[model samples]
Target: MKVTIERTALAKALGHVQSVVERRNTIPILSNVLLQADGGALILTATDLDIEISEEAPADVAGKGATTVSALTLFEIVKRLPDGAQVRLELSSEEGRLQVSSGRSQFALAVLPEDDFPSLSTDDLETRFSMPTSDLRRLLGKARFAMSQEETRYYLNGVYLHAHTDDDAPALRAAATDGHRLARIDAPLPDGASAMPGVIVPRKAIAELGRLLEDAEENVEIAVSSAKIRFGFGAGYLTSKLIDGSFPDYERVIPKGNANVLRVETKDFAQAVDRVSTVSADRTRSVKLALESDRLRLAVNNPEAGSALEELSVDYGGDPLEIGFNARYLLDVAQQIDGETGTFKLADPSSPTVILDEEDERALYVLMPLRV
Candidate 1:
């Protein structure tokens, strides 16, 4: 394979795909990127058997061929090369190496047979849908903080994306929970998304895809099957294996009959909990919250460290209630609230409390109270 490409464009395309490739691999070919320069563009493909990333960039094709070269080494080489310098890539079958030349710098990287690289199949997807990159990003940001790190409950380790049709209209919902706190965000279902199947995206896939979504705000194409999911936009495609286990019936966990509702400035409540929690010891930082009329007080008491008491005015109509919640949990939920007011609905101090962005009804959060 031989091609000449602008150094920055090559680096950007290769850099995105190389992130999915691990530094060390049991199969050597998995660390290399498959380059195809036959057509009008240079196609770079990399995978680790579970996730496959492919990106295409415009290039000057000197010859029509394909080969595999170390993805990391190529990325590092392009990164160190002078900006705006053009790069030339040529593969030599006899030498079993790929030559990378840019301006005054030149390097020879070892190559592997492209056939040795594992190919992740996409035949398992059952449904496909499309949404703007901005909407996908909003859903991910709202829910990712609640994803569980514990592997035993593998379903909770990724975001749960499924169809949601409420009284207003059908919608797509993204939800994540770690048993203690849960984040559920719903957006208007795009045309033709009603038939999409529910799936739990794995943690690694979400992490990598989130990085791409940071810069993609126009449109994102999504396809899902039984075992794999693919996201496409522009000239980049990310294919990842979905978690096979069944996600818990999350709807049943959400509380319905909470009568007491209190509204406060989201930032103010977040800051208060953050400041008071600092006085707590490393292990336990439970904050007791007392709500009465329109006044809310947050306090943390520990024998070793003194206690902290902070108060904030809020909107409340029901009788006074005291609840004990993990300070960190409160802070996380508060941060997720998009509006200025933090609306917290409660059944009592012990029952699960629900928080919402009062200005928007589409997103709701449930936080299980922690015993103080």
Candidate 2:
């Protein structure tokens, strides 16, 4: 295959496709990206058996052909070329390699047969929804951090997406938990989605999708099936295998009916916890929060080291209560709070407490208490 594509344009497309390509592969062809030149455009495809990404860019084509070249090698060559330069890629059948040329630099990459490359099947999708890139990015960022890495409970390794029927209407719900803390966000459902199936989107897919959606405000089309899910942006298409295991019924873990409420400034609470937890050892980073009347004090005790106590004023009318929580979990939830002040609903010192966004009733967070 012979094609001439701009350096900047080719680099952008390669950056997207190469991320899906595995660094090491037992099969030789899996390390290369399949390049097809036809109809004034160049199509690049890369996959790792479970997930696949395809991107297209405008290019000048002299001959209609297809070939496969190492994705990493090709990307490195494009990235090093002169800015705004045109890159020419040609197939050398006699030498059994592909030649890449841009201005003064050149490389002959090993070529593989296009027939050996595997392609993802395009099955019919049941539910389709269109969402802005900004909204999708926000939803993923709010919940993805809480996803678990443990493999014993395979379902908790991804974010659970479904529609909630709380009242007379349906709302879109996205949640992630690792048994320590949970994050859940609710958004207004789109017009086409009245009913949606619960699906567990794997961690890798969520990470890749976030990278693709960065700095893009255009609309993205999403479709789902029993086995797979697909995302189609204007420039590329992404498909991945859904987790086969069923996610647990997460509603029961979310605490409710906690009357003891305390509203404190998010920035203030986060700073206090960060300061108090410094003396604690690495393995034990627990901080105790003592609430009394209108004053909130954060204290951390370490037998080998020292103890720290800091105070912050909060608005609370309930009785004085003391609770201990992991310093790391408190900072993560506080960082995600969009509003200035956050309300923490507590029933007792041992039970899991609920946290709500004072400005937004839709977003909810539950952090499990710890024994200090």
Candidate 3:
């Protein structure tokens, strides 16, 4: 395969596809990227047998052929080339080498047979819909932080994406939890998504999708099936295998009828929690929140280090309550609140509490309390 591409354009495409290739692979071809040159563009595909990413970029094609080369090696060569340089890639079938040249720099890389590269099957998707990229990015950002990292409970290792009805209106919801904290966010359901099935998008795919949508402003097309999910935008597409296990009924975990309520500025609440947490060790960092009529005090105690206490004025009129929570969890939830004020609904020290943005009803957090 022979193709001429601009350094900047090729580097950007390689950056996206190479992330899917693992650094170490038992199968030789899995660490390489498949390059196909056609009429006017070059297609790059990389996969780890689970998640696959394919991207295309405009290139000057001198020969229509396909080959595979080490993704890391090729990317490094292109990245080091001078800016605005035109890069030429040619495959030497007799020598079994891929030659990359830009200006006076040149490198010969080993090539693998393209026939050995595995391609994921494209089955008929059960549901296909399109939504603004901004909306999708926001949905994932709100809930991804709570996704579980443990592999044993594979069902909880991803964000649960589904369609639902909230307040008599159709909505698209994203939720995640790690047994200690939960996050739920909703957006207006896009057209043609009523029949979409709930799917657990794996953590790796969620992270990749987030990177893809970083500067996107257009709409993103999504296709979902029982076994897989695909996200398409611009000249790139990503396909991922969904978790086969069933997610727990998360709605049942949300607390109801929490009589105690407290409202405070989000910035103030987050800063206090951050300051008090420094007194405790990293592994067992817990902060105690003491609430009274209109005051809230944050305190942390560590036998090895020291103790810290800070007070903040709040809006609370219910009975006094004291609760212990992980300081990191509190900061994460507070940072996500879009409004200036953060609202907390509490029942008791042992029960889970609900937190919400004073202005946004579609987003909330559920946190499990720890024993102080």
User: Over 4 Å off in model 3, which ranges?
Assistant: none
Residue range 1-372, candidate 2, lDDT tens digits: 789999999999999989988898999898999999999999999999888988899999998899999999999888888889999999988999899998878888889999999987866678888877766776778888889999998888888887787786567778999998998987777666555578888899898888888735488788877778888888788898888888777779877788889999999899999999998778858999899888999999898889999999899988889999999889989988899999999988999999888887778899999887
- Global lDDT of model 3: 0.92
User: Scored by CA lDDT, what does every candidate get?
Assistant: 0.87, 0.87, 0.92
Candidate structures ordered by TM-score, highest first:
3, 2, 1
lDDT, residue 107, model 3:
90
For each candidate, give its TM-score against the true structure. 0.95, 0.95, 0.97
The local lDDT score (0 to 100) that residue 126 gets in candidate 1 is 64
What root-mean-square deviation over C-alphas does model 2 reach?
1.6
Candidate 2, residue 341: CA error in Å?
Answer: 1.4
Worst 10 residues of 2 by lDDT: 188-197
Residues 58-80, candidate 1, lDDT per residue (tens digit)? 99998988888889989988999
Q: In angstroms, how far off is 182's CA in candidate 3? A: 0.5
How much does each candidate deviate from the true structure in C-alpha RMSD? 1.6, 1.6, 1.2
